[model samples]
Target: MNLGARHPGTEAAWATGEYIRHELERAGCRVWTQEFSYRGVRLRNVVGVLGEGKGPISLLGAHYDTRRLADRDVSYPTRPVPGANDGDSGVAVLLELARALDQERLANEVWLAFFDAEDQGGIDGWPWSVGASYMAANLPA
Candidate 1:
């Protein structure tokens, strides 16, 4: 889940998207990948939808990207962090929640989105919620 690496770009982002898609599908949800581009770099936003019909759709989202290797740490600024808590942990929680919702047969449509490029461009450039920003911008108006 290291979306921040040397020239990771779309490959790493897509890999994480695939993982989320697989998990959501396993939970009996219809999964879709929303693809977009930022700075000519292809990025993906994974959306898993469960249930159907009208009313407001509830969304749970988390970014699955890590900082570039250059901004990793002070000692090893060029190395990528494990991002267990930063990346995978949130996704894991969401996945579990999706599963639980499925088991309980929730009524409302639940959409789980994993945004890409959220952690890219570093703290100075992209900021913490770039993926959220992307999601907000592209969500149904």
Candidate 2:
């Protein structure tokens, strides 16, 4: 559970992405990663599909990236945040739901969307929810 600070464009974030992919596979979902670039830096969003039917589509999303700097912290504005609740908590919930959900009995297709590059907003000309925006723009037809 001690994954350290998983900020975008960091090794910890990449490792965390790999862990999420493995967990999604183990939870009986077909998983994949969607790669995108921001400010010349490559990032990705992890997605897992729980069903293949043509019914409706349901998406469960959470960001996995933490801020590189704790700009909100008065004393440690330059330091990184541990992000236990900022981003990790949502990841935890999504992973648990992936494990608990029954894919076979689902009436609609469920997509577990773990996004990246979402927390470093307004810093260095970055915007919020970059990963989510990319995914939304590139959704399957």
| Winning model by lDDT | 2
Clashes of each: 0, 0
| Candidate 2 per-residue C-alpha lDDT over 1-141 given as tens digits, one digit per residue, 9 for 90 to 100 | 577998887788889999999999999889978988888887999998887683889998999999988999999999998898999999999999899988878899999999999998988889999999999999877
Where model 1 places Cα greater than 4 Å from the true spot, the runs are 1-10, 70-72, 121-124
- With a 3 Å backbone cut-off (N, CA, C), the pairs that clash in candidate 2 are none
Most TM-score-accurate candidate: 2
Tell me how candidate 1 scores on lDDT: 0.71
Q: Considering only N, C-alpha and C atoms within 3 Å, which residue pairs clash in candidate 1? A: none
Model 2 scores a C-alpha lDDT of 0.90
Off by over 4 Å in 2: none
